[model samples]
Target: MSVSIIKCNSYRECRAGIDKALSLIGGIEKFVHPGDKVVIKPNLVSKKRPDSAVTTNERFVHEVIKITEAAGGVVTIAESPGGPYSAVLLKSLYRTCGMERAAEGTAAALNYDTGFTEVSYHTGHTLKSMPIIDPVLEADVIINLPKLKTHAMTSYTGAVKNLFGVIPGTHKAELHFRLNDRAAFCSMLVDLCERVKPTLNIMDAIIGMEGDGPTSGMDRHIGLVLASASPYELDLAASAVIGYAPNEVPTVREAIKRGYSPKDAAKLDVMGESIEKVRIPDFVKPESHFNLLKLIDLPPALNALVVEKLASRPKIEYDKCVSCGECARCCPPEAISMASGRPVIDKSKCIRCFCCQELCPKSAVRIKRSLLNRFMVNFLK
Candidate 1:
């Protein structure tokens, strides 16, 4: 497999830059054929604008639609952004993420289909089958557009992680609460990628979030766009671009364990600029990540104490919290509640999925890490 990395300074130049990236990988026509139904799935995880680096850039989305149209492929932009899953909610999401404006004057249509078709995952890693939105299942080709960002749970959010958007509404939260462990949860993510099998992946790294990301974080200038046919290899390559050891991401680690990606990523024929040329030297990692725990040799009581010590728990800052109830609505296990004017987290019930942190628009939730936990995370990395 081959991956293309190009320098894309801004959205104004995204089209030419995307074209160049596609050209390096044999162009868009190679994937989109005439009369094919193309579904472009992008990261619309929240209601934030593109400049916040919380969602995929609309300019990039528009360019992909244009290319698919040029290839005579019928295009639809589909994604179940965070909120109620319905035609009404999707329509609102389309406007929030600029999907409606991006598809305007283009043959691309914005999807508001609330219907879903269940398919067997067969990966058997975590799920047997999942209900996917109709647009993805009906598409002849799927074009994945993902933003490069840090994820508190998975460590990195890139090609493989973005495909999780296909799971449709509340099922996403249910899985997060069930397989709360990063390692176990990533098995589901890998399975989703295998089942979805996108025809192509285009990464939006022109502006990426770092620190406490995928939702709340600082936007930094990454100034690049990437394309790959294999999401696994694309993630492997993206990890390098972000200056992360591929193993730092649970999805990448899981892929390596399952031989989805080889340990020697040097085997890939990387086109365009070298990773070193565009790599972020000071790129930040997620503020909190899962800890490696082994309790086989320890006493049960001691193991429980150690587990509590090593894990980073979410804490709501009384001063910063807005008491919006968004956290309560998204807490997969229903662990958070609004008390008076503050959000109180049930530490015992908290799954550490960081859904509360990710959904907190006010950035009030902080990942509270103990000193020992901090040292352990660094050592493990």
Candidate 2:
């Protein structure tokens, strides 16, 4: 397993960077055959524009579409973003995320199909069976186009995490409710990757999000494009480039435990620019993801208790909130409810999945850690 990395300073340099990154591994022809049904799964996590670093850059996606189509592969851009997966929502998301413009001159078609098929995966540790989007289920080749970003719930979001989009619409909230434990949720992600089995993985890291992300965060320029056939290995390298220990991200740690990827990303075969050359020494991580309990060797029961009390919870910013009820609608455990045009949380039922923070359109949700957790974080540092 090898990962190819190429320096890409801007979207304008996307085509060359993508081409070279693919070439380093093998080539576009290696994965795409003539008359192949290619599904380009870009990370349109929400309706945010590409410049926000919330989704895959459209220029980067467009170049992949062009290259795939040139190789005699039929291309379709597909993604089940953060809300109800309806034709209307899909149309708005595509237009906002620049998918419409990206597919303007190319033969790539934007997917509006909300249909899904349940596939059985007995091998999955956490997920035995799940509904996958139709386009992905019917594809001959799945080109994973993911953006490198920090996630409040998962810490790092990359190739493997991108596959979470395969689960259609509100079922994602159900899964989140079922797998409230971070380890279980991450293990499910690995299982999803195994089930999807992407043909190739390409990551856009020219501008990546830091601090609270996958949506709300500041953009930091990293200027690199990365690719790998193994989604696990691709995430291993991409997460490390942004200053995370391989084990720091739960998904990468799960992959390591499963023997899907090396325990250390440094052990992987990396081409083009070395990790040290592109590594950001001070990339900000999500505060909510930091747990000091890992350092203490408490009994299982006590550990779980402390982690629950100390874990970060979502707080609604009343000033920033538009009272849109988005947070209440997306809450996995139904812990949130709209009262007098404002959201009220039932702390007893809260699961800390941060779905409200993730799917909130107004960016009104914030991660709030307990006072003891804050002290522990600073003390540990």
Best by lDDT: 2
Report the CA-based lDDT of candidate 1 relative to the real structure: 0.85
Expressed as tens digits, the lDDT of each residue in 67-111 for candidate 2 is 999999999999997669899999999999999999989989999
**How do the residues 170-288 of candidate 1 rate in per-residue lDDT, one tens digit apiece?**
77898888898677899889988888899999999899888888887789888989999989888888878888776667888788888988774566578998887777768887768
Per-model TM-score, in order, reads: 0.94, 0.98
Model 1 misplacement above 4 A = 290-307, 339-341, 377-381
Reference-based lDDT, each prediction: 0.85, 0.91
At residue 238, give the lDDT of candidate 1.
82
Q: In candidate 2, what residue range of length 10 has the lowest lDDT sum?
A: 287-296
Show model 2 residue runs off by greater than 4 Å. none
